[model samples]
Target: MTLRKRLFWLFAPLLVLALLFAYGLSQSLILSRFDRQDAQLLEGEAVRLQNLLEQNLRRNLDLVQSYAQWDTSYEFMHGQHPDYLRRNADPEALSEMNFDFMVFLDLQGRVHAEQWLPPTLTDMFVLDGQPPRSLEALRRAILEQARGLIQTSDEDLYGALIAVQGVPLNLAMGSIQDNQSTLPSAGTLIAGHFLDGERSENLQQQINGTLRLLAADHSVERWAPLPSPGVFSLNRAELSQRHLPNEEQQQILLRFSNSLGQPQMLFELTRDRRLYHEGRKAIAIFLAQATGVSLLALLLIYLGLEFAILRRVSRMHQDIAAIGPDSSQQRLQDRGTDELGRLACEVNRMLERLEQSETRDREILDAIQDGYFEIAPDGQVQAVNRALCNLLDYPAEAMLGQSYERLLSREDAERARQDFALALANNEQIRFSAPLRRGDGSLGHYETRFSLIRDSQGHFAGFRGILRDISEQVAYQNQLLDLAYRDSLTGLGNRKAFSEQLRHALDKAQREQGRLALLYLDLDRFKEVNDRYGHDVGDALLQDIAERLRRTVRQPDRVYRLGGDEFTLVLPDSNSVAAQKLAERLLAELQNAAQIGALSIDFVTPSIGIALYPDHAQNPEALIKAADSAMYEAKRERNRVDLFHPRLLSSSTQSG
Candidate 1:
């Protein structure tokens, strides 16, 4: 064979192999992108479905609370009104309100009225072999369950997913309180939503996906375990050609547990993999066409090749290599309408595009608030953007060529070096936060994301990173957390913080067999102080009292402001004697005149009440209620310390 023929045959086979490899690589890339997109879509849809279910439950609770607060419903619960069920609990009205079951119970646990959406399901109840003769019995059962729930929780309104007769229902119960006065609940209203096939269909329509109501069978092992109560969990089938017969198609499963932490439902989603198959088919076709075109092009090039053409191509390659970032005006010499000429022109165009893209990238980096930087594999700074210079309080010229340690403390610099080594060794990205030392000697908090740079041969070349100053963001978050737990006026723990402390203290006392006491204090004539003096003086006095309480209490014994002039002290490992002594000391200190600026105020005596854990009450709410009763008793006698006693509850109620 001639020389040209030998060259054509040699290059043709290599081109075909390259085309096949490209086809396989393209298929892998396309499949990866599709997998990620499908997973994200599945997770988003799962969240939407969970939100829908939660919204339905919230809507039912709001409806129940609204009706319970109405004058007619309150009166009906208080009194057995004539035709109350017929007027208000009508089936049509219940259906329109989207309530599956609603029951009103008096304080004595007598069911006044009850209604069900699907009237037939009421009689076909599967909870018992024989359905109740009257709907009143079922209503009473629901009310009893609600009462049990309320006794365990502090909220006047609470909800849970309850199973009755192998059916799931979103149930919420609320106190039927007089709108004008909420104290002394007149009755309670129980509301529910039966998760039947129709409701599932409605949810499917809203989400545009199939909704399967899996049986809450804990025995049936799931691929993806149920999430924590009220949280949604998502899982997708592992992408593999060796899938099972039923799992040939891509599938996603979403599972969420009810408030009771039992498996509520599993939603199986079948994703359309048609695009993936089509993409592979298209790549195969392109590879076949490319292979054939490569042979023809090689044959044509072999025929056209001459010593002069080879020399011109060599010259063009040299010209291309000579062009650099500073040589923007350089262009390839276009000799004629030929392949080499067109190739040379394309190279020039590519260079122009690269220059424009580099300018655009620099502009983008400068516009960002975060610092952008790159470092060589040896840990030397290669490039620094304008934002990075501003972040480190250094000029770009001074920053470039310096070690990364320039912007970090010695300890942090060592940490960064270790992290960089790890990223390079493992060929992975790393993220960390550290204190950054600026050029001005001041330190600021920064978070950095470092990605390893690799060459075409997959060897570690350098590191590129983004650094963001998060000092303000972190400070603001801390401020928000403090505000949530601390009282604004007294800087003491607020009601929510106090509740958490009390619960923890009670648990500790019970677990360790130790004593715990809760002291409830009501400043005598505090309202008078506010009325006689302005609220400013009253607030100052409260602050002073809070300081005194904190000073009097021993370490680990916290004081909390429970709104208004009410305060609570959680003292772990304390008995009646110690608690009484501390209460007396608190009263004595509070009675001492409080100095608010130039003003001095005396005659502030507190009616203190003490309740011991495991003696007065077991839980926080009961303990607080016991202490409140004793506090009321002390208030009547004026500035006395009263320990919680069973008789105090009735006596204080009678007096009030």
Candidate 2:
């Protein structure tokens, strides 16, 4: 073959392979995008279903509570006894009221009375039948569950309403009877159904509708309802028996239990292969048509460019190769003003423009101190500048086409996703600070600006933003703040910070009508340590004592080094007994000799003074003075927690 023909043949296979590869990649990308969209839709549906279930359950509970609180029902429950059911009464009075069963339970949780339909009531008249016994057991179980739930639940009135309500009776009996004997006994009674057939039917309809929505293509083979007090259950079986003898079917079985742990409903959902196959066929046809169109377009472009441009370029290259540098002024002759001629002219201009653009872009990128990156919609890194690559310790080529999430620390990925979602939803910029993972497996804190990139049509295309390494700035600010408010020697809150926090705690306690304990701790013989073994040893001993106090107290309690060896602790929501015990524990822990280099320190008991807020003082300064006065008294008593006394406060002021 000639050179052009040989080149064409070699290029043909490569062009075909490239087209095939591109088609395959496009198909995969489309499928992945579709899968993500479908997953999001499914997740939305699940959340909707969860909300629906919660609303329905809450509504049902409210309805049940309302029914249980009816006046007539309350009267019947309180008046009717078990023996009264045996008395033969007119069936018309019972017929006037609509109820499948009327059960009455006393405070001791025993079913003392019940009324049911004639035939069913007669069947359970002896209470020996298996059905009646099972019914009794179920009722008792439900009552016990309700009782336990009410105990821990925040709904205090729910249990009280039910317990106070009376059951309806046919006529006024014994203690319930008054001067209302002239009232008709037939239609005057008020009897309500707690969980009758009508309510159960309505619930069943709702459940079936939900099942249809959830399992649209599946067939329910069998469904059975379970009975209980204030409970509903269903059993469902999928119809998987094939019409043809040789065919196989798939079935899914499900059992639903209520909060009482009783099996209330069961159902089966059978997968329909017809629907599945139809969906698959639609997807396959779509993929095939998409691939065919893409390949055909790519092939036509490749062929047209190859013949009209690539062949002509080859000839121009050979001519240039034969010419010397002296003949560089010689230009290729143009035949027609077709696309290839326009391309040649544009190529010359493009080269000049490209150099200038490249230089400008490089300067701009270099000038930007913050790390800038461009990410595609699929989260792939499209472009990362030098600063970013340097910050992450990754080469530009290595980082490109990598997932943006990989650049964030693993612990911060979820938070990053939330920020990303908010930015995308609002189509606005978001500022977030999180740790970015580096190549060396260390994390550096980065403050990033995430903004949604949109096309001209206003559709979200991707993201383009900058991230700055703010670790040093943040750390320096935190250190400065710590130095201002924290004790330099003991690493506890300073006296000023402690006083502010204590005042806030006192205000909160008074507003909430809660308790607050102020503890003033003055280390015994602490001055002697500084005098005997330098201030360094004293400082180390103080730090050790501060740590011991912190460990001995509850996590919510605050310990502050209130200058020198005197410390103050503010225990919110703590009583005097707890504070005294904590004080004793602190003294015990400090009594042990602290080994600071060669200097062994002992006799480090703290004279703790306790003062109750509102009981001792109304203001922060007054509370501190009261506690301080008590501390002096404790010191006089040789290291003990002295409850503040008015006499002691007065005496301490007089002495001072």
Candidate 3:
């Protein structure tokens, strides 16, 4: 081949390859953009679903609370004849509300009067023989603890409801006035209600109407009754067997509580996403068409220029041979009326475009602060900006062609892999936080956003994402949370933390049918100590006492300084015997003398009051109050331990 022909051949393949490369790059970019949009849409849908669920739950709770306050319901539960009341009122009005069953229980947790909507002739009684297996153990335990309005349910009672049970104040007060009795009165039944199919259907209709109004512009493909407890799969089985999975299928689970204060309603929502899918497909097609047209134009230009300028310019290159390094600006002059002159003009234009593109790319990369990296399908770092290298404390040359995972800490690499796998499998974006290792062997916390890179065919290729250093922000937030929940003086849990811990301990104890101990400790001469010594010395002494109490207690025990010299110790799995031992140890710890400067000061022993779970009180507040009263009694007796007595609650109320 001649030199001119050889030049044409050499440039021809380069021109074709460039066209093909540009086409592939455009295709990849389009796919990535579509995937990101899809992920955002899914996240938005999930948030909407969560909000809807919360609204439904709140509405049901409000409805239940309203029914509990009704006069007729209260009268019926208080032994007034319901038949007489029903005759006086409209039965249809009563039946309008959805209620499966409403049973009034007496103060002692005994069933008295029962009312079932769509009244079943079969009588439902509160079983005294044994607690029903259906009710959650937690609810049963609550009923055993509290004397007033107790709402609970068993497995049989699937719906949510509000139970209002308390002493009939009107009846009890009247009886007390007539009898002139100093004896404490027993509690009486008041009222309660439940939600049934009629009520559920009514609520569902309201919600469906609201949703329809909110989605006015959008078409709702299907809205039907959610499945009840006993129903088999509604189209679920058929969908699972399909060869090509449907992305438009949306499912929602709805649950509501019954009148007996049990969750019952189980519903589902399957909405069609046909419109959403169609819109996305149309967008993809439009993008693909635009890319194809651009590629065709580039290919024509490459073929036209390859034969014209590349062939003729090589033959005339001898005229330009005298060009030295100092004459770098010299251009090749191709003399021809046909294609050579046009090809030379086109080459100069192409060079100008390349220079402009490079400038724009560098500007864009420099504008971003977050580290941006793109990895090839084989896990090699194909490209990385300056920000990425600077963030990882490495040079651009060092990062290019390196495994992207090598820049991350071992834990971060594992987490990144897991997140990438999740995004690919589910076709979603995965966001997570992990420690990124620096060159100095220290870890920096980074919030990473991982998205699966896909080919034009929608096949998994690799991942591309950005990393942000969120270590400072996370640390500040954690510090705020700690300050909010912790005691400033002793570094122990504050009142808020103590209450939460107490509730958790109570829940565990109730579940296990185990006893928990709440000990109220009052320093005998704490005020005198503070007055005699400076506040600083008193504060130091209190801190010392807190440390001693913490050391003396078990790991499971939680001690709280409830302001001043008063402290509360929560002992899980502790009965009266165990509580007494703890009290003795605390008294001994404080009875000894301590030297504060020149004065040898003697500390007063703590007057301890103990309350056992399900024995003294049910709730945390009640338990604390009961323990407080017992502590007062011990203080009255001069440094002793007092077990909670019901009479103390009554006497203390009278004294107040």
TM match of model 1 to true structure: 0.38
Candidate 1 stretches greater than 4 Å from native: 1-9, 107-110, 119-152, 218-249, 274-292, 298-656
lDDT of 2 at 135: 49
TM-score of 3: 0.39
The best candidate in terms of lDDT: 1
Considering every candidate listed, which one attains the maximal TM-score? 2
Per-residue lDDT, model 2, residue 237, is: 20
Question: How well is each residue in 1-656 modelled by candidate 2, as lDDT tens digits?
Answer: 56557656766677667666755664566544554444343333333333333344344334333434444434444564334445421244445443333444444445545455433323322211223335455445445544453333332122111110111111111111113434222111112233223433454454422232122223446533322222221111222222221222233333333333433332332333343344446667865776677567657766886787777877666654654424533444444488867765665466556666866886798678888888788878887788998887878888888987887767677787787788898888989888777888888888888788889998888888898899898889889989988998878899888988998998899899998989998988888888888898888898888787778877623888889888898988888788788878877777789989887777667798888887888889899989898888899866677889999987767887
CA lDDT, every prediction? 0.74, 0.60, 0.58
Question: How would the candidate models be sorted by TM-score, starting from the highest?
Answer: 2, 3, 1
- Model 1 has an lDDT value of 0.74
lDDT by residue for model 3 over 154-250, one digit each (tens)?
1111122222121100000001011222333222322223222343345445442112111111222443333232211111110011111256544
| Backbone clash count for every predicted candidate, in the order shown | 0, 25, 23
Off by over 4 Å in 2: 1-369, 375-382, 395-431, 503-516, 531-537, 550-557, 595-601, 612-619, 645-656
| lDDT at 424, model 2 | 92
lDDT of 3 at 209: 18
Ranking 1 against 3 by TM-score, winner: 3
lDDT of 1 at 630: 86
